[model samples]
Target: MFWRLLSTICSLTSCLNAVRVPGYDYFDDSYYYELKNLLEAPESLHGARGDHPREVNGWGPGLELGQVSGVSVDLEGRPVIFHRGPNVWNFKSFNATHHYQGEDGPIAEDPVLILNPDNGKVVRSWGGGRFLLPHGITVDHHGNTWLTDVALHQVFKFPAEAKAPDLTLGEAKVPGSDDTHLCKPTSVAVAKDGDFFVADGYCNSRILRFAPDGKLKEKFGHFGGEWSDSGLYVPHGVALDEARDTLCVADRENRRVVCIRAGLHHHTFGTPVRTLHPASRARVFDVAIHNGVLVGVSGTAEEGNAGGFTADLSSGEMLGEWGPLQGFRNPHAIAISGDGSALYVAEIGPNRIWKFTVGKTFLPTKM
Candidate 1:
C-alpha cells in the first residue's frame, strides 16, 4: 500500500537525504536503498584473475545440471552456455499467468553448451528438447544463437549449423505485455545491423527491440515504477555497446548497471544514459561489454555477496570487484571476449564456466 508505506519510510531513516521528490531521482525514491554508500572496488582491482578455464569437466551427455543460467561468446570465440538440464527454478517455474507451471515439457538434456576456450571441452552441443528454463545466451555478429527461455516465455534464433529456430520471439507458450508476449526473456543483445536487444524479463520489466527479422522494434522499460533509477527490476542482463550506441542493463532489482540511449543510432531516451552502482552488494545478474569494460555479475547470496564487478561504462566508474571475498559463489552470467582477452563466467551452483585473464587490455575504446 503506497509502496508498502514507502518501504517503511525508507527503512526508518535517511531516506536518501530526506526523500526529495519531483521527477524524483530513482533509487532515492525507489523508496530507499543505498547500502553502505556504494562504489568501492579498488585494492588494485580486487580479487580478479582467479582462474579456471572450465571446471565441472564432464561435458554434456547424461545431463544433470540445473542452474548455470547463461553465458555467451561464440563466432569462433566459443563458450556459449544456458544450463538447467535437470531443471530447477522452483515454485513450479513460470507463473503470474505467463504460462508453464509444469509440464510444458523439454529439459531432457542439451540445454545448449559449447565450451573449449582452451580446454573447457564440450566442443559443441545442441539444445536437446529445445529449452524451457534456460535463461540467456547470445552469440551474434554472425554466428547467431540468441536463446532466452525462462520456461519458454520465448525468444530464440539459432542459425550457424542450426538445429531449428530460424528466429522465434515470444508467444510459443504465451507470456504477455503486448507486441507478442515475452515475460521472462532475460537477456539478448545484438546489432551490427541485426538489431536485437531483449531483456523483457521476470514479469514485465521491459526493454525490448527486435527486427533481426523478428519484428517488435521498440519498448523500453517499466514494471517497477517504484524501484526507479529509471525502473526495471529483474532486467537480468542485456549488453550492446556497438561503439557508443549503448544499451547495457542488468538492473536486477536495482543493484544497478543501466546504460541507455539504445542502438540503431540512439534516440536519446529521457534519462539513464549511464547508471552503475557496482562494488557488488549482489544481485546484478549479468552484463558484459568488452574492451572499454563493463562486465558485471552478481547473484542470489546478496547481502552476503557473490562475485563480479568492473565498471567504467563511460565514467560511471567503480572499476573492479571480485565479490564475496573472492570465492565468487553464484555469478550468473557474463561474457567478454572479442579480444578483450577472455573472461567467461557463468555459475549457478556448480554448473560452472569460469575463465578469467583480463588484467588490462582495452585499445578498443569508445569511452
Candidate 2:
C-alpha cells in the first residue's frame, strides 16, 4: 500500500527505490546469489569446466587490444587474434543496419596480432592499414591465415610470413551478390582437399564454395525461411570437418549450429544433417571443431559475458558450458589448441582474450 501511494505521487524511476527491495543490491543480494549458485550447482555440471581469472600481465602495453573479432591457433600452437584496434565497440548492436566503419573508412590500426598463450604477451603483429574491418581469422593446414572483413566485404588468404595476401576474394570495399562479390563475409572453412567454404554473412545469408585455386565452384544456403530447419538467418562462423567431409555453420540469429556434408569429388553441398540448439537461447556467434568436439561461443558484440559451450558433433548433445562466472563477455571468436589441451576465447565487449584449460575428460569420442 505504501509503495502504491508513492507511485501515485511520484515518478516510477524516482519512487521505485523507496520501496524496500532485497537481493537487488551490490553488497548483499549479489553475494547471496553467488553463494547460492556455488552451494546448489550440481557437481557434474560445475565440474565440467574451470578457468583462471583474468590475468593482470599478458597483453603488453604496445598492443592496444580493441574489439577482438576472431582467434585461432597457428601451426606452431600460438594464438592469433584479429581485432579492430583501439576503438573497441564500434557497432552499436548486432542487428544494426550499418556497421560503424568511420566516415572516411576503417581506422588506422593493426588488425592482425599473434599473442603468446603462456603470458598473453604480443609475440608479433601485422596487417596494419589494410583491413577495413577484421572480423574472422582461421589458420589452415598449410600454415596460412584466412581472414574476413565485414566492412570491406572481402576475404583474404595470407601465406605464412607474407605481408601481401597470396589470394584475395571479393573486390576491395565492394559489396555484391555475384560469384565474384561478397556481402559482409564472416568466416572461412578450409577443407583437407583444398576446397574452402565462406559464410557470407551480415547483409547476405549464403555460403560460397571455392576450389583450391580460388575458383568459385558452388553456393548454398538462403536467408530466413525457417528457424527449425536448414535455412540460415545469419551465418557468422564456419568450420570444416576434413575427416568427415562435413561443414559446420553458426547460424547466429537462428540460435543454432547447422552441420552439412560436402561432396568433395562432386563439389556440391549435401543436405543439412543436424541442427544443434543450446538449452538456452543464444546468439550463436563462432564455432571451432576439434577432435569431433564442437566448441561454440554464444553472445553478441554489444552485451558482455554470455558464455561458451561444447557439444558432440556426432550426436549433437551439449557436453558442458562456462561463462559469466568464468569471465567471458561477448565471446566473439574461439579456438582450440593443436593438441586440444587449451581453449582460447576472444571477447569483444571487454576487448580481451581468455585462456581456459580443456578438461581431460572432454574428449569428443568419450563424451
Candidate 3:
C-alpha cells in the first residue's frame, strides 16, 4: 500500500514527496533510497563508463593497442586481451581496404596478452604468429582459453597457462562451408559437459556444434542460399546458458538476439524460444551473461548512435541502454567474470576495453 500510494502520488505530480506522509516509514529504513536513485536504477537496462581501462597502466604511454577484438577474464580475474600486435593503426585501417574474406596470412605480431587485473600491466603474452584476424576469446569452465580468427577461418583452444594452442578447428588458412571446415568463425561458447558451439560467421551463416573430442556433431542455419526457419542471419556471437540448456546467438544483421533450446547429446536445436531486440538496432556485436542477466554491446550504426544494454535473462526484453552520449563506440566483444560481478567490453574504434560492475537493482524485487 505504501509503494502504491507513492506511485500514484508520483504519477499525479511527477515527484515522490508530493504526497502526504502517512507515517515515518521512509525515514525508518536504514537504507535510505532517494526517489531519483530509484528512478535511475533500471529494471532492464545496463550501462558503464569507458574510462576504467585507461585509469590502469599499459593503456597509458606509447604502448600501442591495435583493434582490441576480444577480451576474457582468467582464473585470477585478470583481463586477457587479444590484439593485432603493435601496429595498431594498420589493423584498424585495413578493414577499409582489404576484405578479411579469403585472407591467408596471420597478423605479423603476437596478438595475445594477459594483463594484471589491478594495474592493467602486461603480465604475459604469446600467440604472435598464429591469428590473421583475432576475433573472440572465451575462458571455459576448465580454464582453457579459446579464441577465433576470422582471417584464418579457424578457432583455437589453448590449455590453461600454455603458450600454444592444443586444439584447433577448421583447416588452417582455408575457408569453406563444410562439416570439416569453418568460414570465418566469429565466437564460441562451451557447455558444462565440454561440448561447444561456434558461430560460423563472416563468410557463412551457420551454427556449428563440436563434441568434447573436437569432432563435428551437428551444424544448422542457411548460408544465403535461401532463408530457413532457423532464425539466424549473420550470427556473430554464441553463448550457452548451462543452467537452462539455452543457446543465445547474437544475430548481428538481424539486429536481435535469438535464444534456442539445445540438447547436447541430441545435437539439435530443440525449438526457438525468444528473440531479444535492442532499441537502437545497431549491430549487436557480442553478449555475456552475469547474475542471470543478459549484457550486450551494440556498436554505433551509420547514424552514429551506440550503447551497451542489459535485458531480461529469460525474455530478452530491453532493460536499459547507454548511448553515444555515454561514450560507447565500436564495441565488439564482451565477457563477464565467473562470479557474475564484473563485465568487460572490448571496443575496436578506440582500441580499448571498459569494465562494469553487475548489481541486482535491475531485477524485480520479491514481494
What does each candidate score in C-alpha RMSD?
20.2, 9.6, 8.9
- What lDDT score goes with residue 220 in model 3? 68
Model 2 — TM-score against the truth? 0.79
| Deviating ranges (above 4 Å) for candidate 2 | 1-63, 87-101, 104-107, 265-268, 300-305, 324-326, 364-367
Ranking by TM-score: 2, 3, 1
> Residue 246 in candidate 2 has what lDDT?
71
lDDT of 2 by residue, 102-210 (tens): 5445657668888877777888888887876689999998989999987777899999999999899988767788889888899998887778999998777888889
For model 2, where is the 10-residue window of minimal lDDT? 51-60
**For candidate 1, lDDT tens digit of each residue in 1-367?**
3456555655655544555443234455222322221232235444333321222222333434568888888878878788877767888665668677876578777878787777676776888886768888888889888888876788888888888988788777777788887777888888888878788888888888877788876788787742465688888898887777778888887777778877466466424686777654556888888655677877555456676767766677765565331356678888977776677787887667777655443224333
lDDT of 3 by residue, 1-367 (tens): 3466556654655243445643344453423234433444443343422111111212323336788989888888878888875433345523432345433456666688777665567788888766777888888888899999776678999998787888899887677887888877889998878889999987678888888789987776765421344756788888887666678888887777777776754434646767787887777888876545677787664447577777776655567775322467688888877766566778887787766655545422221
Error of 2 at 258 (Å): 0.8
Cα lDDT of model 3 overall? 0.70
- Predicted model with the maximum TM-score: 2
**Which residue pairs show backbone clashes in model 1?**
132-151
